[model samples]
Target chain A: MTASPPQTGGPWRATGTVAALVVGGLGLALLGLLLGRADVSVLGAPLVLGLVWAALTRPTEPGEVVVEGAHQDPDSARVRASVRLEPPAGSELALLRVGSPSHRTVDVAVAAPRSRTVGVSVSGVRTGRQRFFSVVHRETSVGQVVGTAAIRAGPVTLTVLPRTRPLGHLPLPPRLQGLTGSHDSRRVGDGGDLHDIAPFTPGDRLRRIDWRVTLRESGRGARPGSLTDLHVRRSLATADAVVTLVLDSRDDIGRDISTWSGYAELHPEEATSLDIAREAAASIAKAYLEAGDRVGVVDLGHHHRPLRPAGGRRHLLRVMHTLATATPSGRARPVVRPPQVPSGALLIVFSTFLDDQASGLAATWCRHGHRVLAVDVLPPLDRGRATTGERNVYRVVDIARADRLWELERAGVETVAWHELAGDERTLAIGLAARARQRSRPR
Target chain B: MSVADRARRASASARVALFAERLVATARIWSPSKSRPLPRVVADIGPWVPVWLVTAVTAGVAVASAAIVTRGTVPWAIVLATIAITVAQPDGPGAGIFAVTIGVLLVASGTEPFAWPLYVLLATVHLVVVLSALTSGLPRRARFELALLVAPGRRFLAVQAVAQPLALLGAVVTGAGVTLPWLPVAAGLGLVVLAWRLDVRVGDDGDG
Candidate 1:
């Protein structure tokens, strides 16, 4: 990042106070001499002496201030700005102001010869690019500000990444592809989970044989069985599942519908529906990736940036970074063609469901034989303080939205409200059961 | 008590309670803690320049009126105008003009010593004018940062405090009809220079 040149003018000139004191003192002294009033001259002496001393000692060289830690963690990023002067012995005062109108300004003061670093702690309230620092320095005294220089440290940008929450075990897709992973594949292989026991074949190893079952079979009730009647324990094969996250970032509305009108331009400090979607998507991606599943993200808002399904901790970080930069753009509409999904991948669509586009897309994915789960990211409404007319209007809207969700369910798409799933463990169990039933049904 | 009497007493108590609540509400509305509605007259004054100008005029008028009332002279009008100008523009030249005007007014009034309170008030007005003009052009954020620098600023104020008293003492001596010799004045000037040099040396050492 290139630093902008310092802005210097106006206040950089000698302050009016200094000029007034110096001229006033000399003028009074001359007048006193003319009038033969020794007391008046005596009174002017101090002003003269003070201004002279201040002028002789004023700082001349321009100082440099460099602001560090411009990029900070969204949760707790502390920015420190340090200033250095060419002649450090000057008895001038330095002042630092950091932040823009979107955030509260932080003020710091440092005395010359012992100027300390100024630190500002920022809370990750608003995300995206923001101005971090703007500094101004002044060489001032008690009576006058002698010189001033504004550090034009160009626009300092700070990007705040979205905060992630920890999600527990998530249901995976029915189809498993990778050779080595954590999920049970139901095929016999060398694994810990027992699948079944069968008669020993020619290729079966000695360690696989169940000796107790073999011995019982050999000594059958007063009759000796043949040595050929042996059995072996078989273990199920495990493979990795594929999960693709679809994010609908068309509109981010908070719980309060009244603020939704202007919310697009000026988002409230509270996490909006989009923020919830980002956090939820990030958590789900982390959980599945850690479980040895391939996770990918498709931005419904910007189709140009799509992350293909891949598995690893590094891939999880990439998905999170992409989610942090996800912003609501363009008009809300259903995808013309369903996004390419890995065959039989569990498609999780995170959206507010204010419009039918996200629901339609989820239904489309379900039709393509993908296990599509629609997460309703809208916050619960509170109509207790609303007027009768407002309540009636909202009630009508709610009924219409409920019918849309019902239609999605009828289309074999499992719809889950984000708040219900977040608060209740039972809701996740129900979702898991629904996924199981859908997977068991013949296609 | 009869039912009717009890009911009437209850209604009266309710009325008293209602009255008290209304009184408290009115007090809150008029309280200083609540921001006063800005007058429409000042709604369009965007910058602090006009505010500082008004302040300077007010302080100048107060000082000039006090000087006139104490000295009983009309020539103080020049001093008042000069002070107003100085307050409005608080530059070196304006301050010089104001000082000259004050000196000429005193001389014209025949050195009949003004009250010490009046002199102190004049000094305060001058200080206010100078400080206001100096800070008039600063942005609101910069002003806040400058306020944070007050601790270090006290050092400069301390030096001024030490220097100004000596001037005051000299004035007191002269006013008491004492013919102050040049040697002590020279010595005082020398002492001021010495103190300034010592301060500079200390600052240099601190930096090192």
Candidate 2:
């Protein structure tokens, strides 16, 4: 991100005011020399000195810089910023510029005198990625004198990404025309070759009963050239299944309602979006444990790390650790490759589908033979399409999303488009489940 | 630049900037009410005290010195009376001023030169104490204390500078009666204020 220019013009100008006072004093002293009877040039010296004193004594203006950002976990999200006396320090007081619910200002002083970086914490908002644009500082030095300026404008947007959830239900392809032994049911069917069996019971049929058995028991000769009849049970062998979840949090959601302060928190510093994702992934793992499915996550936002597919509780913890501290790579932070789909498992992608790269990645996963499930997260109100141009952009995004949805459908994968979840989780979830089953039908 | 040179420059610049900002902020953040309280009559005594005790002590010394004195009821009497009253009263510039004013008045009214010289010496000592307190090395507190002596006439100057022409309109109704003794009262008030500053419990004295 490009750094903002530093602000100037504060108590620095006190010297000018003092210089004016000095000039006045010098003028007075010259008058004293011209008019007084005794030689008074020496008196003028003191007067000149006083002028210098005033000029030198003028107060300095305040210097300040503001830094705002947001963070999220699977459970919640936070947006916050703080202003401080910029480096090459000259002021102590820092102000917070929070937009909306009436612009609120909070004053902060560094306990370590001129501290440049101060930690800010916002809890109990939501569990998702949050972003802040800029920070402003109003600094004062001499008296109530003030100098207003922008300290830092973050071109690199910060993101608090949504956390992941592990596999809840892992299903096997019941019937496939190509595959034979493993997935297909063998109970009372006529597909695979069989072995020997035991004697007949009440439910056994007499057809051929192995006419040899009847003949042997009744001293009858062999009726036909076949073996005795019997029923057998078939058990199919288990196979590995890989399910990938790609989460894209590229849309700007926190626009109109950016931050809310003083929300009572049970744990003052609650988990952010990444934290929630970690826990969610772990919970999903627990759900999949008995179902016998392995899980993995794809981080589509800007991050220090790359795509990670893990299994068991240990893997979930690893994902959680990354989510807790992942910062959006602003434009400069390198582009990340979406995680590759593992063989045999379904790919379930969770993303807002606003950014082209993210949407493109989802489509790529589907084409690669992965059972892709692209979960489209509705962008927040601020990120909502506004101008005709933006609406058009949204239209393009919607069309792209629709195309991907169809692409996944053609690829025999499920696709779920959802709003902010808590409001209508049940219907949307049930619909997604139904779609999952429908997509599972044999082609 | 070399690492050492860069580091040195960074450190020094940081120091200069911090020092400059502190001085500027200190100069502006001044409060006077939080300053010493003096010049008021009720200020001298603490709560729940007897008024007669104060009067008796002040009057007793005046009477004693008047009755037995080589220099008669002039400077000696006032000097003796001052010492006695100052000790009986609270410790402050006001008490000192009260003692000296009474002593000087007696001297000017015909006390011996020797007796009056003592009063002059005491007055000079009082002035020195006040000046020293002002330049007491504490930035904010020192400046405020210094204002008492240097700008003693600040209020008077303000009125004359801004209100004299305005005062004429009130003359018809209030007469010249208002401005008469006010100058002396203000000066007296200034002295009383000096007293209050001395009364302040600065170090670990714990006395108000």
Candidate 3:
């Protein structure tokens, strides 16, 4: 953070109001002197005295203002910019202008001889990489008649992340790897799922012995009705699943069809398609990570940015930070297919099926034996701003998108609409995970 | 240059080109539109409504008082109305003109010094000027904290305190039939010296 230079903004220039008062006062008193009307000079006394006081109290030293930034409250979009004002002696009010989207400006009368932090609120800001604390501030001298030069402090670069919804059950990989995790693995070990029933071995614990089975086997053995051999129950080992979230940042189109073209940029305040994709990817990653599964993130448009699969609460934050860096790229290096993930990792592709490129890549992943789940991140259609020709073009593109989605289904890829997931009901997600678990069951 | 140098140069150019593309893509982050509904980010102009209303009413009061104090005729009233229009604007020069006009009328009307009307006009002029300065040069929907008025109020009181006494002294000197030609010059010189004191650094490494 940088501080505004010491007001060294040159001497405080007198405002027009000060000149008005001086001119008015001097004119009256001089005229009274010429006419010997002492009453008139008396009448100008207040104005003259007022000007003298104002001149005496004007700011002398150049005071610097350091804008100490405060982050926006997570629950709201109002960014409270806390500015610390170190005003010169006898300075009056401070004017701060927060220039960006809203161009909100505020005036606060700060009493001198002490520093003060004023919080100016900025609302309706869009998510993504944006600037903050770009405050142009100056303190007023007597009566705000004169003040220091305006100084701009900073345009601090901050990446505001997209909002993520808390998702319910998310699908997992076919073969979980970690021995100590949430899902049941087919490896023979002690766990919740039954693996086998057999005579107890030397290494098996007494807790594994099944009393009814032991008695039945003993009766059938040489020692009738007596415990001849110990029987035990064996269960499958618990393992963790790996899930990699692939985000398609090719285009961040908004609901308005007209703005989809490269000529017009989407409104920064509204949630664009990339925002939806990031939010959906974050939600899915969080859900899988919460289940003690290893989760990763990859940008399809920028293959250079990738996070290897890892399981932890910290890793979830890393996933979110990576997602926030996904700029709405219109032109990126072209690729034949999406980046590869770990073997048997669940690949969830978050994309706007505006074209066949994303669907084709997802199908390729599915054909490569990775369970690919496609999430549609297109905003709902509201053709209020579109012309008749644009609307017709949208309808044609919409149909082609639907066909591509159908093609994905045929290619064994499940497409989930991110926005259509109503409330807390996640039956589709639960079913998908349950079906994967069923497939991983032992014969 | 060798073949290796050409390859390296090509890679650097490619990187630069990609950077330019990304920059161009995000050139227009946001733009205001009538069709797109405004985002719900506090953009509240709620604080300025009362300030503007108060300023308008005060300007009206100043105009009415200026006319009444001067004992204005029809032509004077019309001139005062024009001044009122000037006062309606931000940082208007109307306060100076109105004050001077009232002073001219006081001299013409043979009004007694230290009269109640004189006091009334003085305070009214101050009020109008200060209030106009308070809302000067700000854009529509600009906000101002109420605490900002504290300094202006203090300055107003301090000025009035000194000015009222001088007003009485001038009246006494003239009433007693005394002549002091240097009084006006001395006040003028003091005004100059005081004005020169602006932005004078007096042992301040500002701990403000």
Candidate 4:
């Protein structure tokens, strides 16, 4: 830290050392006169000459300090900011300080009398909105005789959407809706899967009749004569599944519970429960949408309008965006009522399950005849620094959460730990998805 | 603008405000909340170490030079006190303390005008004067571009070139029983005018 920045922008001024030298030189001259010593008075001669030189050589204008071109690759963790520095003519060097992702600071210095744009990179960033490049800069003269005011420019920010990951085929609602889709339903109609072969009656399509089966049945002689009782192949109807993702964003706690009281700060790099929840929700929504299923989202915290169910790539983007913006409400209001879901839509809830409220909502959604899958999005606890009392508190909370998860399982709402992995080295969500596909398959 | 345009602008402004708030929401409590005063030194990174080194070296050189010139307890006390003062408040008027003390001590010692030690003492004095002038009023953490020293260096050499020989000439002329107090004053004025006339602009020619 070289100089304290002034609150307001001001013109250049001489440094304190210049004033000190001037006063010291003058005092020596006086002392020399008092003592009648020529050498003593002349001892400070170089100082006076140096001051005169510095005075005449000071920079005339405040140079430019501009910062622009902030870039962050979606697939990469680094954020780069480009800064343009033009220290005025007499300036020896210019210094720039910039704030990076997760609120870390970086500094860079460049020799002045030149205009240059320098790029600084910051790494280890996660998905979210952040102030990428806030810069403070100034130019100082040689000997720092005089310098311009320290100026602040730009705290440029950008929002990086939550990333989507691939998942196995997910579970569907008990009943599928819509006429045109990739998935087959229980309702009998024209589809890819043959439902059964039965004796044809009036209104049966003639093309669906199987002559080979009719002849075989006639040989058995149960009820079929030659072409007397035609057999027609029937297939299931094509319909799309509708899934609603319920995100409990009321409390964004981390593995370290010490910061729950808001006194100790939780750094940005530390992944919070909400961050995990968003990634999980986005992955599920993408999977469902890609499978020709309509997916929607509900923020249990903000009882605001939940996203309506829809299909296609555009709706998938909309779901991801909504998931990205889901943030912790940071307050407690009793969940007077759970956010509403589409009738017969599958509910895959993402939550920490810290309290019974979120689990209770999943149970309630299950009771409504929707196939509910409650995802426990809590991160692993860091018990290394926990005190005896803190561990006890955490133990009590864990017991209650574990019971809530157990109750969810008993309620026939599938439960999976989002942070856990299965034998295949995939997230437990993939296991949940595989189980869902098995249950939806024709028995 | 149309009413729809005005609405759109308002919505955009609100969105920007919300985005800024979200960016600082969790961050403000950590590094972004309380103002972390940027030590306005223009280095690429933290310059506290380098600045501390320069200040320490300069202060040591200044004290040593003051001791050599004065060789008196009172001068030594005053010069030593400036070091303490620079630490407590670098922007204070402590830098000239040493130079003034040395000059007074030299006169009391009655040293020869052409003494070699005095010339050596003068060299240290120029260094202190230039460095102290650059660093005294600045923050202790101030980082300087090394090239910034070149101008002061050149100025030091230029002043010494004229002042040293002129001092010898004064001693010679005084031995001949002739006194001229106005000679140093005239020479200083001449140098200043000459420097201004030359008016070298470094930024225009080579890459800054």
TM-score for each prediction? 0.69, 0.36, 0.82, 0.70
Better-scoring candidate (lDDT), 1 or 3: 3
lDDT of 3 by residue, A262-325 (tens): 5664555567888888877877777788888999888877868589999899998898888888
- Cα error of candidate 4 at position A178, Å: 4.6
Clashing pairs in 3: A7-A62, A60-B199, A123-B41, A124-B41
Interface RMSD of 1: 10.6
Best by DockQ: 4
How much is B185 displaced in model 4, in angstroms?
24
**Which numbered prediction scores highest in TM-score against the true structure?**
3
Per-residue lDDT of candidate 4, residues B72-167 (tens digit):
677667667866665445554566776776676665566666455455566676677666655543445444434444455556768877666656
Docking class of 2: incorrect
* Model 3 interface CAPRI class: incorrect
Among the numbered candidates, top lDDT falls to: 4
Native-referenced DockQ of model 4: 0.20
Tell me the deviation in Å of residue A63 in model 4. Answer: 5.8
lDDT, residue A167, model 4: 75
List model 1 lDDT by residue over A1-443, tens digit each: 32334444223457666766766678778876877776556546545765766667665555555555455543353332233332233435554455542344544333444444444444434554456556554445434536564554434565555665556557767678676789888667867799988889998888999988888877883558656578899998888888999998777776555445442232224567887788678778877888888998998888785899998989988888788788876675557887788897999999887677888888888888888888877877644433344466778878878888888888887777666655433244365566557657999
> Model 4, A272-340: lDDT tens per residue?
888888888888888788888899898888877899999899998888778867776567676877777
For model 1, report the TM-score of its A chain.
0.81
CA lDDT, every prediction? 0.59, 0.38, 0.67, 0.68
What DockQ do the predictions score, one after another?
0.14, 0.02, 0.19, 0.20
Better-scoring candidate (lDDT), 1 or 4? 4
* Residue A246 of model 4, lDDT score: 91
